[model samples]
Target: MPFFDHVGPEPDDYDTSPKQDVRLTQLGSASTKTSFTCGDAFGWANRTPGVPDLDSRVALDTSTDLASIPPFLWGLIASYGRHTMPAILHDVRCDASKAAAGNGGRARTAYLRRHADHQFRHTLKAHADQGVVTRYIMWCAVRLFGFRPLGVAVLAGIIVSMLHQSSNVFVSVSDLLNKVTIWPWLSWLDWVPQGIAWGLAQLATALRPNQPYTGIMIAVATISLVALVYRSFERPAAGGPVRFSLPALLSLVGAGVVGVLTAPPVLPLVVVTMVTRFVLWLLDFVMHWLDLAWTKVLRLIDGATPSNVTVPEGAMLPAAVPPFPGFFPTP
Candidate 1:
């Protein structure tokens, strides 16, 4: 393969080459129905030019399971397909980077992680089968959150909002206690800590003072904007669960200032996006559960043991059963 400066793999990358050895077998885990094990070696040689100068060889063997799609995004994307090669490649690279970091290459981990994201974005752009919007969203998600789990990303967004709410409550209670000369017992508790309370209180009072949802709006907007810049050009964080870097920190502060000034009008839009996400997640969960149940039902109707219905190599479990009962053609 020749190296190219352009984004994405070579155009011939879309073809299924026999040399890739890309067979997969679905595991029989009820809890992880979406998981699949590679039946043979799957490999990608990074020929995309201008990416980080990390190792170009990546591979997945029989022991490695393909990454499962996050439940929240399932409605927007399928868990498995030829179009998902970019994601699969990304997963292997991230795992390899984690392993490298685990073996005391801590200083270089952040750089490796960034390269993985870059590689994923470019490769995703090359897949003509996936829509432009879908690729963009996936790229943005990888860039924003890196290899962090969906729960961590969600919590990151919510924690700031919670801090804002807690700060307001703390200041309000302190004020209320100050006026209560009638209760000397309550006054004793007021000696807690005013500095921390007042600092948080400033967030609530500084902008959109009367609005309770201001924190959520600012938090979401600040994170979204800062993450865009952070992954795009900001210095990568030191490796660990917690991510922090001077450039990212500065970006966050700047985005926060902008968010506080501009997020009020977009508060309703933020609320709607959050609600819509929850609804989509719920629907995805229900649909997945139903798919698994229906698979079992079909096995029972066909007189085959559900336990024995293993997914063969290079195959996916069917997404659904026949919709109508008559499709079975009862004798």
Candidate 2:
């Protein structure tokens, strides 16, 4: 932050007295609604209250006072020469927000400055968000790599082995529970959740724990990559900006190549898992996206004025008076 020298109107700096504080407050509110930011120049008034400076100048017309601005601010003004000297100032923020949200999708800009500075900001922000997500996913995969998958496999395998041994005399877990009300052992098979667990263990070990935890990890990684690709095709919007990212693509390709190298024994299970997840997620996002259609419908119903859609170049935002009535001299 560059140091600013010009202090704003103090108690004795301008004719305004106690009302100087009140007027400053009003100017700040005006800045929020429009870009003619007079209040921003005198921000010290709010942060530090004292006598008004003897040599304070609050010029709302940024284009005219180029020489009076400090060196750093002058450099900024020089860099934006065209806008700095414009006869009227266009509010860049209002244009950007409306266009990106699709509310003013019909409006298109031909001006270079307006297009790059305002219209392009949203696209840049989206790309930044995608980068953060890609990093997070890769970080999680790396940190959880060695032991976590093995632990999950060991737990799953033990349950499978126990279920197989216990069902020897009985036909199923339900039958075992009925015949042997043997406290802890039988009680484990009593509930719906326990029954689901028994079913999963049976599937995982149908071929037996002769296959180790590494195999389970390979199968899971394969399934996840397959689901990601399927989901890419299944819901293009949901794939997001990350889908096209080089790092994201490379990480995915690497996972798939390793899965093929291992040739895990559970290809059938992996396919089923990937396909089921894609289908459910596809149905879900479709329902949510359907709601967004109404905004377009409402805009159409109300009827759009093509004239109101575009912001003209060198347009000054309306000069709203400070809210403190009678604070200024009558022209």
Candidate 3:
């Protein structure tokens, strides 16, 4: 017979002798009666047929028998214990009376409301801080410069921002190509447009004839103002409102005044700025193509075979040899 079958449903069946009849309780109920026999009580009866003792095998209650739980369920319980239990216990303690009175639902709702309010306050404060910092930086840069200074600064800022945006697009495209294309080989394709733009700017500067420096400064300033006004009116989502620093504003005015006094021309500067921006757009286009290639490669790879295949050509292997010839001599 199974060991469990021999263990009777009463404490006395397993215990060879009994003395006290203490009432057992669960969940604060005195009327509840537990029917399971203790394992140690039964073992004791077998060891000493006439003497009553606690059964070792059945002494532990089923609800607390952690070993009886399935492995997955045990892991879930353990994870909850480590992460969720503390928060749950805190909440329970805060509303212990309500929970005990069977209003656990209301207690949980209250806890959630408090958590949300705390999170909202934190988020709002962070956003406000960021806004203040951004505005202050913009004011300092745009308001300080005069006409010429402002123009030059704006030109540099626009180019830098465009380049930053283009690089992000390029990286995303490259990642996609690597995923979709089979042994895709065009990682360098994205740089071609940027190179062309740089070459164009150099050529324009070299070809331009010497003129009044003042004239050239004026041209650049005019173009910058136009760009600024256009950006503000169009309100493009990709690049939002343009902000100039104070130093830049002051520099622009100073340059314009100097140019008017000296009568020097600076048209070539405007040309160069325009050419640089055109190059950035070309770079963006190349990046888009790379993204398309990457997406295609990923789809193809996904359709072909299980990712864990062991072909020698595609399988990963240890490096064959170092590319460098030898270690350098210490200086």
Candidate 4:
């Protein structure tokens, strides 16, 4: 019985011939659907300006859902990722960071609340506490207002132009998706579902590049531009809903600045200008579209208000406004 050569009962099940218990360690990640980037407000460093370091920044995403979105559906939606995620993440990060720093779960919001003006904090809290779905829908409305989807004519033109096979490598959304690995910079576009239709017209002419739809998109775009311009000049009647926003003009101005900055020898200045105009046009389109939708919604709500509630003679009405009889509970 040469126990030295063969395995034997030596301290439990240990091999007499030096066995290695190799455990493959894996990087662990949280099972959370949420992560925050207080834009690393905490990690931003020392204030002693005599030897100050640069206030470095990172593109912050306080979104839980973006990280959780299925790989296939990331494009087209991620660009419009601002809903409730950022706010939620901000709150969570503040709380966690404070806790980690051994400050009794002193959430950043809480700390800020202590110092913030009461009105501001109250407003922040109100917005922060809004139901996720409602807030998300609100954000969707915002997205609809801001982002102009590539129209049919625009897409067709881009496609036909591509088949003509000019030097442009960027063709369709499919092309972008296929060549994704090569351009990892565009990887963040994974959640941008609209990126599927990003082949939009930069110039007005591109809107109706083909003879078949030449008049269609041009007419639509022109009408839309006219309506937007008209609304810009038109003042809201007294007590009427103010649909036209100043943000659109600001956006156009910002776009102009961006176009100027971005136009280089490689990318044409006309392309930049056209794209800017197109974006503003899109914004105008969306704002009106949303305004119409909002108008309808408001009409419904207003219609719900019980009219003709008879007031007795000499009966003083309550100081407070009466609640909508059908929708709101009477206090």
- Name the best candidate (by TM-score): 1
- Model 4 TM-score (2 dp): 0.23
Worst 10 residues of 4 by lDDT: 322-331
What would the TM-scores of all predictions be? 0.44, 0.19, 0.19, 0.23
Return the TM-score for candidate 1, rounded to 2 decimals. 0.44
Per-model CA lDDT versus the true structure? 0.47, 0.31, 0.32, 0.31
Candidate 3, residue 139: the lDDT equals 23
Report the error of model 4 at residue 165, Å: 8.8
Pick by TM-score: 1 or 4, better one: 1
Error of 1 at 17 (Å): 5.9
Task: Candidate 3: list runs displaced more than 4 Å.
Answer: 1-127, 131-133, 137-184, 187-194, 207-214, 222-331
For candidate 1, the per-residue lDDT at 112 reads: 63
lDDT of 3 by residue, 1-331 (tens): 0011224666555433431121122333232221222222222122334532231222333211111111222222221222121212222223332343233343332232232222222222332222433223222222222122443545444443333434444333433333332123544443443444455444334334334333544565677666433322211122233333343334334433443332212222333333334444545666666765665576568774335534457644332222222111110
Error of 3 at 29 (Å): 62
Q: Compose the digit string of candidate 1's lDDT tens values, residues 1-331.
A: 2122212354323223323225666667444334565543333444432332334333334333343445333454555665445555677677766776654354345456666766665665654245655555455445444524322344345445554545555446444433432135444334322333365466546533436566566665665654544433322444434444555334334433433443344343333333344334444666778888887898899888987876669875755422211111000
TM-score for candidate 2:
0.19
Best by lDDT: 1
Model 3 residue 23 lDDT score: 19
